[model samples]
Target chain A: SQTIHQWPATLVQPVGSPLSLECTVEGTSNPNLYWYRQAAGRGLQLLFYSVGIGQISSEVPQNLSASRPQDRQFILSSKKLLLSDSGFYLCAWSTTLNYGYTFGSGTRLTVV
Target chain B: AQTVTQSQPEMSVQEAETVTLSCTYDTSENNYYLFWYKQPPSRQMILVIRQEAYKQQNATENRFSVNFQKAAKSFSLKISDSQLGDTAMYFCAFLGDSNYQLIWGAGTKLIIKP
Candidate 1:
């Protein structure tokens, strides 16, 4: 079975601190990766999506960026975090021909 | 641009009752996909049901089913014998074939009383 692994299930970081959240998928190759954030009791906001390595399309222009250095490894980073950057971050992957998405457990980050 | 609208922000129903959540979407493309996802207190998204645009027959899985009206661009989810575990945030999403990225609506919070 295919599985996704995300690190640091929860984090509390101070404002202006650097951030790095990692996500990796196993049992799949060349999967379409995506990063999404959801506000408290709200809907999902698309941040970034990668169709292939070195190719990333950002949906929202904000304090974060995504990098797809490897086929199955995707990393989300921020140089300086803001109080508004706090939310639940999710990682998802899908096959090229398949429209169905498989999402990770998600990371709950709180900026204090 | 494609968009999804979930009119009901919150709804409540007694256990074992049947409830229908409403969803409507706007798109210019003919081929697309509609999905209903469930998020519990744990906040993990679970695919509840999906409707493909090219199909006329509605999709059903166990006690969950969808009323898909392509002409009206409306897709509503009906849960039979609703259980307390059905208490969660339900999100309606649209994915056009041109753009596979999903367009999400402000989720509806469904609370099932025991």
Candidate 2:
């Protein structure tokens, strides 16, 4: 079975500080990885997705950026965090097109 | 562009009763996929059921099933014998066969009162 792991299940960052959230998948290779943010009482917003290493697509324009450093490792980063950046960040992976995504537990970010 | 909609904002059901959540989507693509995801209080998204556009027969899990109407663009989920653990926020999702992205609906909050 495949498993997705995210670091710092909960994070508290100061405004204007930098941010980095890591996601790595085990037991699968060349899987599609995605980054999503869910605001309180809102739908899941797709921030970025990577089909392969060094290939990334941004779904929405925001302060966050994504990178696929390794085949199974994906990273979401920001140089300067904003108050609006606070939300529950999730990382997901899929085997192929139109397949159901397996999401991680998620990282609750609180930017104060 | 594809869009998903969950008309119901919230629904309540008695324990052991059956409940259905409504969902509709808009898309121009002929080939696509529909999915239902569950998000518990923990906020973890879990796949509940999925239906392919080309399949005529409805998809069913142990206690969950989907009524897929391709022409109407409607896909609804029916949960049988609802359990307290089944209480969660349900989201409808649509994905184009050619794209790796998924469009999500706001979600329907389902509560099972015992």
Candidate 3:
């Protein structure tokens, strides 16, 4: 039984401001964590993924960056937010490559 | 590189009817996994069905089933006796052993009318 928690449920940030979205998994050890962004009417876009602590693989180059400081903790951050950065950010976890992912309730970011 | 495609952007079906959502993928890997995920208005994504490339039998879960054509690189999902609760965004994804990233398709919005 594993659960992923992502917050804050919704966020409103000013342009050029910093951003930090946190995701943590409970009830699983050494799980693979991922960060995805879904723009309106678009599919999920992979931003970053981590197989273990202190290991991060970025899928695309963007204004965002990810860090896995702990086994169950994955963080997505940005030093300067852009207007295009506004979207629904999701966090997901999976035990293996063959299985499906369990996603957390996404964070709606509105960069005005 | 692996890519998934869901052509239908939106579809509607009456309650109690059957609906099939089409999905096609392109991949060079012989061994991989395909999955269908459902995201309700609440935005909680859940796995509807999965098919392993090595298996010939199509995978089915309750009222949900998959038509896996490995050679054709097509994997479609069939929802039987659709309910209003079935209204959601359905996504197709592909995963291979070479990459941990799951390649996703542009989702199809399925609306089950009452």
Report lDDT per candidate: 0.93, 0.95, 0.94
Q: Against the true structure, whose lDDT is highest?
A: 2
Residue runs of model 2 more than 4 Å from their true location after superposition: none
The collision pairs in model 3 are none
DockQ top scorer: 2
Tens digits of per-residue lDDT for model 3, B31-93: 999999999987878888888999999999999999999989999999999999999999999
DockQ of 2: 0.86
Docking quality tier of model 2: high
lDDT string for model 2 (B1-114, tens) is 788999999999999999999999999998899999999999999999999999999999999999999999999999999999999999999999888888899999999999
**lDDT of candidate model 2 versus the reference:** 0.95
Spell out the clash pairs found in candidate 2.
Answer: none
For each candidate, give the TM-score of chain B: 0.99, 0.98, 0.98
Candidate 3 lDDT by residue in tens digits, A76-102: 999999999999999999997688899
- Residue B64, candidate 1: Cα error in Å is 0.7
Give per-residue lDDT, candidate 3, residue A56.
97
Assess every candidate by TM-score: 0.98, 0.98, 0.97
Model 2 misses residue A86 by how many Å? 0.4
